[model samples]
Target: MDKSLNTEQVSVEPQEKRAAKPVDRPFLAMLGMLIGGFVGMLSETSLNIALPSLIAELHVSIGTMQWLVTGYMLVIGIVLPMSSLLQRIFSTRSLILFALCDFIVGAVISAVAPNFAILLIGRMIQGIATGLILPLMFTVATLIFPPYKLGAAMGMIGLVIMFAPAVGPTLAGMILGLLSWHWIFWLFIPFLVVAFILAAKFLPNVGDISKPKIDWLSIILSAIGFGGLVAGVNLASDSGWGSPAVIGTLVVSLLVLAWYIRRQLASKTPILNFRVFKKSQFTTGSILVMLDFAIILSSMYLLPMFWQNGLAIPVALTGIVMLPGGIVNAIVSAVAGRFSDTISTKLLTTLGFGITIVGLILLLLASSTSPMWYVILAHIVIMMGVPLAMSPAQTFGLGALDQQTSGDGSTIMNTFQQIIGAMATAIATSLLAFGSSAAGNVSHRIAFTNGVHVGLWFTLIVAIAALLLSLTIKGQKWA
Candidate 1:
């Protein structure tokens, strides 16, 4: 039996015609996308380590260092909706090729950047490129592989994409330990070159959609809405939530978002069809995805800081501490993906979140005087919950849509992922900073502990909310 298609009989000829050529190298093609994922995620964390050096060299304030991150996030959030439009306009083959070139250019600019401003420009370009690359890769995988194969293919994709963050600190630590910060940006040049080579060799010219005409007004509105929303979240974290800058930007964001929706509803050729939300499964699945990211991303930000500041470990050691958890999460993702086909998603997602909360509670009990085993056990338990939760949540969402609509649905889900990540990170970081400031003369240990406690409790609440939502999601088996 062909492992690619469903057991239930369907017309094989159209599938064969649409299928990748006999010569198509699926794994090798997958490697190229994995490399893109690695580059995108590595760049994100690597820069965090490089920021202090960046500030020291460029003589910028703490405020300014944020642009290196915030600007990249803004561009990513803004360009994400365009990904589905691009796919509808251009084939996955062409879009991936073009996105790689954009990424390479952004990388080169950053590699040679002499000042902070140039670096910001380069980072923004790279973010937009990443926005295009990630969901496009998922869309392509769904298109090329048979439905049965999608689970494993998507599982592999999940490993590379999600593990990048969990493991980024370790890799960045090693790089920062051995070389200057500049090497981080320069490193991707070679990978981008390799990705280009693979694209020319094994990637097929699969579809014939031309570039979609730009909707400038919608684009402008989306940019304003997403940008203001993210900026408001960040500002609210640092500045008081009541501050004019924070409140005003949030208000503007809400208004623009409303306007963007109206535009989509009115236009025949909207940037992203708001109609996707009308589907009950898609809408519910999207909410679960958003909540999942909000939890995972904020936890990523908080965990590393816990190891580094709370325990007073070096960056390298922090990564070492997290190594087991990252490895466990990777190992479980494939299994979770397979299991999702057989079991109820609600049970798995609830179990996953509940386990994570338990882990967090254990971690909360941790102190510098705690035994190494205790710390390791707590971290491992937390990490174990991720694959258990994420795999089912993601598969259930995408599975709800048919192939024609999958591209658009996948892009929307990923866009929300990035948006939630940025918001959660900003909020968590701000809370940590504020917590530390408020606890003056307290030992760094105590201050950090307080921050982690607050953050973890907040996440716990979020998880409980997600669990409740997951219970309401009607599971549909795709594989």
Candidate 2:
């Protein structure tokens, strides 16, 4: 056996030993993590609704102001692949505290920001917190919860993850209705404080602290590689694929990522283990999870635009129309988690994709004259499909790993999610632009509706691919 593999196994033994014995107050620990995770995720999409308001208040162009969202996502993607390394280095309790502190401080900075630069800085800081909290929540859940209960636990975690983005626009819409844009940051303050308190009180020191040799080269490579890749893809929608900036960045990103992968494979003590892919189940699950996230994000991106821009619904009303679907998504996510514990993920995921395809077809059929009720029903159906597929697929994927590799598995899963989200959004945007351009001289509403349909069709193709993949999932449950 390889010496580094031996060392890795030895390092995990202590963690497993600790986890084998039940800790006091597991539920509180989970709650603390969930609260922090929820608040962090909520902050991600919440700002979307507030962007227009911010544009007017800050006197910035939409292109420049988008960095608040883009930069935040970019920072999260850069930091996510480092999570397993951090997990191995820091105790769970210490890491949780650091993440919460980062989040709270960032929120303060954002709330008081007098300019876009400072606001962008604050958002990046908060992104660091989100990147840490999400994977940590999954890793900690696997460590603390017994296998029998993991589905439900991860399901609840899914609820927070999926639900937060779902409700973000609605919440932001509500906040902006009554308060200024700054208050959006302020709204998170109370939630962050509560989460911080809970975490300080209940989050446990679950993982073993093995101070492995830090690989600066790997760190640098990942920062440039993943960062460059996501940035390139994001810029494609605006810069066009053939633009030198886009092409150059992408070329550099690909070369650096290739080098990074080579280095990881050669290093006995790789910062992020690629060996996790040696498990076929993990790979399948990871792909499925990525597809599911892409579907969710792409739909989320298209629908609101379709409602507000195509149908001429007000921003606040668009949010209100989508609220029921978000609520249903949360409920289904929780239930699906419990069901995965008793049922086959293959069945659940297939059914999910089928329902989602139906919803997408409905969405594609929608016209400018479509009733509000029809749109609402279509959104609800698609939203329902996401949780049905997401929670089980996630639980099944991460659960396949041994306790030792859970951190690495979780990190890989989440890192891909962020990357996929950025790419999907970019692709969806490009398609929309293409579709609009093709509809020459049409009314703006009609042009935008055409774009929306094109995007939905693209999403449908991906969902069909995911459904087919889900059918091929062989294991009935986690091995």
Candidate 3:
């Protein structure tokens, strides 16, 4: 079906044509979005520590269980490009309420899931909610808060974005220790209910709803293109890269994505505006952001496995190990947002990548016998760099855009994050498998460490590339 409404269905009042009043209660509205977003992001990494448990209990391979992470991100990648169109078609309040409901339903399905397939279905459902809520959080912030206050609002959002992932492992670790993994799903229900009530009671309709013709072909292409690409990468770890399933899907995904980009460039009301790339700073910022997410996700995915499986650390201890770094990441992200006001994006991003590289190098030193303290320190260092780079790079990129296209800019940025994250996690998993297999006679612990080192080396290279790209990020004055 066409995703747009018929003319008769769209009642556009003159008042609707005017801009919305900055929200009547910005804090309440922001609070609801933040809480919902925290739940969504917490779900993202919560499974990292639980992967080993799920694999054994569900009789799945590591590659198969990783889907709990990869599948969630893949769904988000597909849904994010459509968020701008969704925002135009629905009021902010209506959308947030629906997303919350969607999440609650998904959580229920996940908590009671009987099999791996059923659990995955539930995760994807939750991903759909996340895809809607994440972009809307920013879109509503821009709509309700004036420019001066925008920085602080975004910093708060960044705090949730960074902190949630940071804390997810620890939280999941703690929960699994005391209760079943099912409680992880149940634990968030109360918070989700609170967020839903707050949103229903307080969220203002912040944006005008307009009837934009949806591109059915674009939607299909996006779904197949991104889904096929991520699926192909994910399967590569199981089937070799040259396997027909892998090569065929990757080739098809690339061609479809090319066609999709061309269609977007030619359309007047594209679902995701490709024109935003015409801005040099936005382009550079987009690349840095994508690489930054890839690095963060890859590390997050690999580290827990390394600790739990490779080093034989208990799940709870592994989570405790990462706790300090998560806290550090959250604090640094907030401070980095403030620093962006006084610092150049170039300087901040450069330093961020530089620190990330050091963190990766330290991670490379981890082996079966390495001290736990060293691993913790390395995680903390890498976590510090991400916020230092991410907050400013994101701000500068979207800041470079005119107010008219900032929503599109946010969609593109968030879309790439999930897409790249899916790819990164897939590739890291593949590397882990490949490295482990190549180790031949080594013990599984050493073999896994071998794979982790390979993955870390690859992430280190991406960070260096991001560092180089950060150097090219010209000031906004030039834009």
In candidate 2, position 380 carries an lDDT of 92
Off by over 4 Å in 1: 1-23, 49-64, 112-115, 208-213, 368-373, 475-479
> What C-alpha lDDT, on a 0 to 100 scale, does residue 444 get in candidate 3?
88
> In model 3, what lDDT does residue 97 have?
95
lDDT of 1 by residue, 1-479 (tens): 57545644464546634534333677787677778876886666556645545668999864467667666877889989788777767777777788789999999998889899998999999997888888877777777776666667677766766676666666666676677666778888899889888876778755547566778889889889988888898776657677999989999998998999799889877777777777787777677767766776667767766766677767666667677877887787658777776777778877887887788788778875666668778878877776677767777777777777777777888887788778777777677667667777888887876787677776777777877887786643322
Which scores better on lDDT, 1 or 2? 2
- The C-alpha RMSD in Å for every predicted model, in order, reads 4.1, 6.2, 7.6
Please state the error at residue 54 of candidate 2 in Å. Answer: 3.9
Please give, for residues 1-479, the per-residue lDDT of candidate 2 as tens digits: 69999898877745433544366877798787788888877776777767656778899864456567667878888899998889879888888889988998999999999999999999999999989988998888888877777888888988988888778888877766677778888988888888888989878788888989999999999999998987887777677788899999999999999999899989988887888988888899899999998898778867777877789887778778889998998889879899888889898999999999999999999998899999999999998998899888898888779888888899889988887876776677678777877888989889989998998888999999999999899947532
Candidate 3's residue-wise lDDT over 1-479, tens digit each?
34355554465535433333555678887788899999998998999999999999999998889889999989998999899998889887888999999999999999999999999999999999999998888777766766656666677877888788888999999998888899899988899999999999999887778979888999999999988888999988788788999999999999999999999999999999989999988888888889988898888999999998789999888888989999999899878877777777888889999999999999998898999999999999999998788878888788777667888998899998889988999999999888888888988899989989988888999999999988787543321
Q: How do all the candidates rank in terms of lDDT, highest first?
A: 3, 2, 1
User: How far in Å is the alpha carbon of 115 misplaced in model 2?
Assistant: 3.4
Superposed model 3: Cα runs more than 4 Å off = 1-21, 476-479
Worst 10 residues of 3 by lDDT: 12-21
| Candidate 1 lDDT score at position 285 | 69
Clashing pairs for model 2 are: none
Lowest summed lDDT across 10 adjacent residues in model 1 is found at: 14-23
Instruction: Estimate every model's Cα lDDT from 0 to 1.
Output: 0.75, 0.84, 0.87
